[model samples]
Target chain A: MPELTARAAPPLAHHFVDMRQQTEAARLGMWLFLASEVLLFTGLFTAYSIYRYLYAGVFEEASRKGVELWAGTTNTFVLITSSLTVALAIHFARLGRGKLAAALLGVSLLLGCAFLGIKAIEYANHFHEGQLPGKFYTFAEVQGPGASMFFTLYFIMTGLHGLHVIAGMTVLAVMAVRAWREEFGPEHYAPIEIAGLYWHLVDLIWIFLYPLLYLI
Target chain B: MPNGEHQTALEPHHGAGRYVAVWVALCALTVGTLLASRLSLGPPWHLLVALAIAAAKAGLVALFFMHLWDQPGVNRLVFATSLVFVALLIGLVLLDSATRFPLANPPNERTLRFEPPSFETHVQPGEREQGEPGAIGRPPARE
Candidate 1:
């Protein structure tokens, strides 16, 4: 039996006809917000592309010389795994397994912290090495123009991403609290669903960021 | 807006096992992309290959993990429309930058050249003097 018709329409916000309509509106709203988020990141991506194009060789050398490739790969794995856990959390929420969902979200939140921890280590390494962006850049390994530009884009893109991680963790924490309180169940887990979507978006951005910043 | 019942019917209830499967696939693709970067394809091919793999991984997360696969078409269109506009933004910038004349481009060590010597500079031995008959870029001498 489908869960949709299992009970009368869950609590409504006055305008919605039923629970289904509410969920649809919630999802649509989230997607639209995601679209705006995409555009926000596109500006940084465009800057990265333009700079890389103008200084192809310099960008390659700077990335090779300054970046810790293995660290980046580790963070990539961490974020992807967290994405999996968060998805599982939502699954549990929909099944009315409140404790299990809460636990999964807790793990996801911890992994996000781990990611930021690793990122801080990387940032400290760069700072100590004088790999600052633009005029502040002083690393001697890569010489000539555009080296600073690489780090500039690097810090800006990853810095913004790190902020998103923090934001997602906060949202997940809220979801975890609600799950523990039994606020979400088989029929009323839309908040968890949307939070999961936001966390996935964080992971999705890192998916692209990994290649653009670390690999190529 | 569709009613609650219709949206509920549309909701997919794929089990945790299926989500795990997508997760495994995403991890494999990540490894594939990392290895692909090590290949010596060079330039656009390497970049394109890596981005293609990333896009594949992102698509999996969006469709399965984010439940976009179960959502209505309007939701999908909103997201896809954003991507189309992004493409337009990047495409226009590249078009403008890629078609400029070489001299008009940014100054870099790659484009530097030594200035050509003028006619007043010391001429090599056995070279015709400036203004001499048949000399290039010199006025013809009176017969």
Candidate 2:
């Protein structure tokens, strides 16, 4: 219940020894959370590797038929750009430049939306071409053994990623609102940084996904 | 100072330029991976190269953008542990596949059902089978 000077530091929780300890603890918790997230995605990646190994030819052909190169690449750029903006937002938030941070966050949110928009377009294309998962798949270009399995894996992996994008966008929106309200500053912008970490993870997942689903 | 509370400097060197530079590198790498995929590296090498580029890109984002470089050792360890486990999962499965007979691979279910089963043989016409196994190639009821 000690009164802190205006320029000193944010009020630390009762259990924390110092702002440094508290921040580190919070950050470590976030990293652990991220680690768990990585583990969750690992299951899908394992499924992908096993299926790809078993049905190499069918998977490769399905990649070509089910996914559009231009759309996937465009979304990749969009997501990577969003990661940069989020990183910059965190950078500015640490400098106590709330407006700049908010602006950059806004940009990142737009790019996130744009990525989803492109994904939706790709999904629509899949629907039109009858390239669906499992038994619903009707695409004739790549039919036969393991064909449905490829689309099944494709829809599951990317669909999960798309959901993450939506979640990231929602988080960015909340952060953007807070940043615009000047809630973050040099002494206390850990939330912004943590959210940026999350957004970057989303981008990171897509970076690998682009090549795996679209290219190889 | 204030109630024996330790204060850490929250402000690091704010370099927008570094972020911009990293962003450029990431984009260039994306394009590079795309170009590499277009090459006829063939089979394992093609996959290996593409994955290497992805790992590099993921590292750049994690170390630079996610501030893992500045993060404490504990956080880094936690992250690295996650990656190691992923490697373990993939590596062990791949090793099993590589070592196993081609037809004996765990995922190769076709070997179990290589021949199409006759449906008519499982259930006779106008014969109401009670408590008997329904599927073909299955053991008879043990009454």
Candidate 3:
């Protein structure tokens, strides 16, 4: 029934009444999907949390011995800044200045790329150090693989997040181009706003992940 | 999206200053969390505090930057649902992990007695064949 209604949207979707409805519905849906995603990763986070709770020293040792604390911290900064760009982009869109909006989005896209590039370096360092996964880890300084699970989760969560960063970059880039052509304004700025929401959610997820994987 | 739920104008939700403000706030919050990470808030609190701060930052982004504040009232419901479900999944999973611990203790010296030992193992098959005590072993760490 919901699908029917969502499909009923004007040749666009069933859930919306107009383009505004479509945009809002889609944005809301994205957030909802993200919520599910948050939970999905929560499983891995929960595992990491429990083990770290029980073996605080192991988790701490793993962070120090295996994880790239510096790189993780740097990526944290990059993500937040990218989020700022997207947010500002939305603001520019609201002001009916498509060109400036697009420019801000471009900045966001660039920062997002920078984040992935930095992440690649972090992953490369991890790989070079043989912090792969499971029994394959080779942290020469660590006690054993017990602490490596932290790294394992660290990689998985951050890797998944990196993928999202890439995805958000693509979305922002496309929207930036469209926005530059004046496809959005006060009445048609939903895409820019939606993109901002998604980007922020990505940042939000990482906010929790950063402390878990890097700090605590 | 255009619908007739109480019909409203698609007026813009943010201004240039608002955009800048959200960005500034986001930066401040990110720096705050980074600094907060330096603090040893203890187990869940570390995650909790970081997330709380992140949420505040994200709220600034969402409300000001994304202009979700003016989009539609229903969108908030969507956000709520997503958050609730995510929380549920986290709650359920953590409940399982947390409850399992008190019911059992890991065997002290990485042993392979009962279940498949959960920790890492350094296996020396030759030494094990020679009845070496350290051959193929681990600390009992799984709950």
Q: Which stretches of candidate 2 lie over 4 Å from their true place?
A: A1-9, B1-7, B105-143
For residues A134-214, what per-residue lDDT tens digits would candidate 3 score against the true structure?
887777777543656767788788888888888878888889997776666444566676677778778877767776677
Q: Which candidate number would show the highest TM-score if scored against the true structure?
A: 1
Model 2, position B142: C-alpha lDDT score: 93
Docking quality band of candidate 1, CAPRI definitions: acceptable
Score candidate 2 by TM-score against the native.
Answer: 0.85
Please estimate how well model 2 matches the true structure, expressed as its whole-model Cα lDDT. Answer: 0.82
lDDT by residue for model 2 (A52-91), tens: 8888887888887678999999998999899998998887
- TM-score of model 3 relative to the true fold? 0.75
Better of 1 and 2 by lDDT: 1
Pairs with steric clashes in candidate 1 = A20-B4, A21-B4
Identify the leading candidate in terms of lDDT: 1
Superposed model 3: Cα runs more than 4 Å off: A1-19, B1-8, B41-48, B101-143
Candidate 1 Cα errors over 4 Å, as ranges: A1-9, B1-10, B108-143
Q: CAPRI band of model 3?
A: acceptable
lDDT of 2 by residue, B35-121 (tens): 998896978988889899999999999989998877657989999999999999988987777677555664444544456545555
